[model samples]
Target chain A: MEKIVVVGLGLIGGSLALDLKKRGDFKVYGIDQNPTHVKKAIELGVIDAEISFSELSEADIVIIAVPVNIIPKLTQKVLDVVSNETLVFDVGSVKNEICKAVENHSKRKNFVAAHPLAGTEFSGPEAAILNLFDDKVNIICEADKTDWRILDKAISIFKKLNMRIKMMNPIEHDRHIAYVSHLSHVSSFMLGKTVLEIEKNEEAIFDMASTGFASTVRLAKSSANTWTPIFLENKDNIINSLNEYIKNLKEFKDLIENNNEEGLKESMNNTNYIKSILNGLK
Target chain B: MEKIVVVGLGLIGGSLALDLKKRGDFKVYGIDQNPTHVKKAIELGVIDAEISFSELSEADIVIIAVPVNIIPKLTQKVLDVVSNETLVFDVGSVKNEICKAVENHSKRKNFVAAHPLAGTEFSGPEAAILNLFDDKVNIICEADKTDWRILDKAISIFKKLNMRIKMMNPIEHDRHIAYVSHLSHVSSFMLGKTVLEIEKNEEAIFDMASTGFASTVRLAKSSANTWTPIFLENKDNIINSLNEYIKNLKEFKDLIENNNEEGLKESMNNTNYIKSILNGLK
Candidate 1:
């Protein structure tokens, strides 16, 4: 059987371990710096065994699922030790930095710079869920740079996990993700902060925040450990998205101020096209 | 059976009529200026009968479920025609404007200024859902001004709908709701607008906007007919919240620009309190 070593056993890694084990295709070894996560993942049956970096050469595959800031360095380290036959992939949210870091590496063609755009607000091995990557999008950036054989292996693995594969330039992936994913997290967090700052009376806010507020702020519950590096690594694109979002917010505020009912209705109507688009526009 | 007339038979009115009829307490009649809404409500059994505004005198209870912009006037008109025993309430999102509209009226004591914080992103009679008010918050603003007997009737009705009742001054309700509810809608709408503006590739945006973006932008799918009036009716308070929200977004952008990891993590950590708070904060 093929041997797979998963580093950073958080939600993404731990979950990958669980589902991968069920496939009966590989023996998955877990590696996480956090001692608690390693023990918990092993106890939870998320991994077949806990392994160290020194043992990485034993594996045919290495999956790096750490936060974005740590991904580039970790991917480089894994590439340094893993044999030429071993395939390495990083599943961080941001792709640019890690892809750039590994671009000039001797084993660049052996590494598949990929991101599985899938997760929950929860984090760590304890938060690992089953079949998380099932039917989700797995983006492989700069696929042409990866060795054809290695890329084929990566695609087969993602397909076995039931994911749809898309290929794009690393730079384009970072730009689009900043708008779709990172900005939503930031907007949710700040909305939560703005409400928290104002509503000192917690119960009252809770009552008013039942339906709409809850859905709107749901992403605010996401882990700081996971998100900090994403916002930092993708700072440029995030700032650009934020600037556009704020400017639109200000225009909306002005429309409300002037009782521009037509303007408000027009904007909202225009945006309602999202309803159809959200029905999984293909 | 006692008579209850529900004005503007849209989602709230239609749903309320359905649930209220299920209680077998009153004969629920619906009146909507849109003939289509009235026809649909009756077709769906959301209302027992269609009635004219002139027939309101026969009602023992009156619910004004019109859009916020028309709520004050329609509520006043109902007050003009209802019998002395009639208990009138407006279920608009903005309470202050509607509450103030009848503050000095001769029938002021007969009206309860209320806002039931419940709804989905969809709208119209077709969107009316069963038991929507169940386990949701129903705010009775300026309750002291409502006649003792009338307020009891309104509370009993809401209780039958399984709502938890809370009371607050109308002005305070408007201010807080702007931050909790209206601000969320604005944030969602503008977020949608921002992404829609940037992603010229609609299909690509849809693929990336699967989970997190979907939740954050869901409210942008809300009916413009329903929300335009809400943002306009609560303009003052909405503007205040939006201003604070815009400022926070700018500060966050600056943090990202500086790659302030600590600052970014701190903001996200603080906002994570929303997770517990959302679990029905004590």
Candidate 2:
């Protein structure tokens, strides 16, 4: 059986391992700096066993699912050890920096910069769920840079996971993701902070929080370890998105303050177009 | 059969009408200024028939489920026409205003100040669904002001609908809801508006928008007609919440700008308490 090695045995990594293992065609091994995660992943059957960095050359594929800040150096390190025939990829939210880091590497053609747009608020090995990437988007940034044979292998694996492939350059991926993904996390986290700060009575929040509040604030529960690095690595685009978000919020507040019913209705009506967009997503 | 007259044939009112009718004890009738909603409600079996405002006097129970801006006047009008023995209530998100509006009415004791913490981003009769209020919170404000017999009737009906009863004063209800409910809507709407403004490529948004973005921005799809009055009526408290929300967003932006990884993680970690809180909600 071909060996599939997954680094960073958290939700994404462990989940991918579980699904790939279910296919029953590959020996999936996990590596985590946290020994507890490696142990738990093994116990939970998220992976067949643990593997070391030195053993990477024997692996047919290596997947890096680490925090975005660590992805660049870790990708470089993985590429340095993996054989030229081995296909390697990193599943981090931000793409530009990692793509740029590997741009001039001699073995760059073996690396694929990918981001699977799938996850939940929970983290760690225990949070690993089956088919998390099924029918989800797998964005391959700088696809042109990867050798066609290697890229074909990566695409086939994503297809096996039932992911829709979309190709975009790294800069475009980061810019779009900043608005759709990173900004949502920031808005949700800040919302949770604002409510938690103001509502001294946790009981009130517990009793009064509707599904709407729960939905809007759901991302607030995401792992700080995973997101802090992403926000920093994608700081420029994220900052721009945040500026735009804050401006819109200030404008909304002004409309509410002035009781500009017409303006408020107009603004929200325009946004209601999202209903169609969201339905399309479904 | 007891006559249950629901004013405003939108999601909340229509759903309540449908559930009550499902029990086969009440002959539910709906009233809406929009002829389309009334027509739709009848066709969907959300209500047995349409009732005119003039016919409210014959109602054994009257539910005022109009927009928050209209609730005060509508509640007063409903009270004017309903019989002394009839129970009446207004289901508006803002409580203080409506409670205060009917405070001096001779029929004040007949009206229950209620904000059933239930609904969806969708509006109109078509959006109504069975069991929408199942296991949800039903916040009754100023219950002490409601007559014992009338309040008992209202409580019993809510129990039948499978809602958990929580009593809070109008001021507290408005304040808490501003944080937990109204503020979320504002944040979500602004998030949608921000993305729609910055990302001119709607196709990119459609492809890149993950479930996280969908959840966080879901409330942005809420009906403007339903929410405009709410934001305006509850402006003071919503404004307070918005200011705090914007403050947190700005602070978060500064942290990202400075690459304050520690600060960012700490902020998010603290906010992650929402996880336990949300888990409690479930």
Candidate 3:
């Protein structure tokens, strides 16, 4: 807990560095392949300084917050460098691959797979903010594989950030996240693509976008580099979700085509249950 | 200019009443098929008082904010009652049908086909709030059919609500809205339906929902009564958008299946243009 190494200076990593630094309890250092982000994180006071991967051995905690595709390799590299007492974790959207990647590593007991359920549409070091993880859910997968000391340290860090922690298997994490997170991104990107393709008049699109459209398409603004991996890594689950989504769309289309008012109404009524779920999430 | 009658006391109608009343520009009265909304509108002071459709003759302007399916009939009734100088407008999502329904009316010149592009997911009088139309867009379709004085009065009213007005053909309005507005509802509802079907563990779904999922699925909370008719009325355009959306999803799926890194990256990069479009909308 004395020294923390955040290995990605993007949104999640940068935010964690800022929060940890503000606590004045840990010396937070950052490492990123992107030199610009590392420099920016230092300049913005997000971290005490930029450190090398070699410094990983001295860190009490190592957090991998890079893209999902890069996370498996990065996690293994960090586990290689960090001491057995150093708790290592990854804040990846998809976790099963990363979990399996290091499941047999000698330092497996030091690594925890986590997904912090929080983010805005923006990215990069500048996109980071204080208290981003506050009051958010942090999902930890394959927790039983981690040593009790490492697990306790991860829990304490999340609690310090005011996050509620939940545990589940990696496979269940991927399946549920596909439905809840990954599929929503696809829906939003397709909605944006559909509107952009059809609306020739840019002025009209800009002028008439109501709050509903804006909110629904917000995730379409997310970074492609970040998302392309998440979608591909969790391909099977995402594809299954997409198939079900398209089927639901087709059923709704039939309802509209046949003017089955009752069926359409019933479908929407059932979907409106999302209100309660959202209320509960909040 | 003197008296305004708003039919339907739901979100759109109630909000219009609140904005016009706050301007102190008109004596605004409300009518709703639902007695609860009628009571709530008066209770919330969203309207001056409840009035019958028979009172339309005395009003200088009448606004129709009913469901899309009821709009054509309601517009016909309003056109029949209002004077030649009295401006009549409907804020239905689908405009072509309402425009066509009143095409042969004697007072067609008094009716301006409009769709004020603003609303929250919540509905009914209780959901109404002040400044709901402020800085929002109001699409006036088939404006050439409305008499000059009526059109000017309609524009003035929307201006008083702090709205930016745009002119469009009724056909174009319905088509564009199907892609931008209507399709968003379907995508969101289907996403909700798909997720709810796959994840019976509500707590897990709720726990994993990030900001992206929450915003993209927000529209699923909309009323079925409000959206069903909109989807049905603009059936062709919605189907077209859904078809394109499904096609895009399939392509994305294939790219993932083949591990076509280049294809996946390119598609996401292209869709990244949405960031610019969204920025412009904001």
Best by DockQ: 2
* Number of clashes recorded per candidate: 0, 0, 0
Docking category of candidate 1: medium
Candidate 2's C-alpha runs over 4 A off are none
lDDT over C-alpha atoms for residue A38 of model 3:
86
Which pairs clash inside model 3? none
Ranking by DockQ: 2, 3, 1
Expressed as tens digits, the lDDT of each residue in B207-236 for candidate 3 is 777647787888889999999888888999
| Shift of residue A277 alpha carbon in model 3, Å | 1.8
As for DockQ, the candidate ahead, 1 or 2, is: 2
lDDT score, candidate 1, position A159:
90
Which is better, 1 or 3, measured by DockQ?
3
Interface C-alpha root-mean-square deviation of candidate 2:
1.1
lDDT per residue (tens digit) for residues A1-282 in model 2? 989999999999989999999864999999999999999999999999999999999999999999988999999998999999999999999999999899999999999999999999999999999989987999998888899999999998998899999998989999999999999999999999998998889877887777488888889999999999999999999999999998898999999888898999999999988877767665
- Model 2 shows how many backbone clashes? 0
* Residues B1-282 of candidate 1: C-alpha lDDT, one tens digit per residue: 999899878888888989999986688898888898888988999998898878889889999998888988878878888888899998989888888789888999999988898988888889888989889999999989988999999999999999999988888888989999999999999999999999787766777876489889999999999999888888888888998888888888888888788998899899899888788532
Assign candidate 3 its CAPRI class: medium
Q: Which ten residues in a row have the lowest lDDT in candidate 2 chain A?
A: A273-282
Candidate 2 accuracy as lDDT: 0.91
- Candidate 2, what DockQ? 0.83
Candidate 1 fraction of reference contacts recovered: 0.83
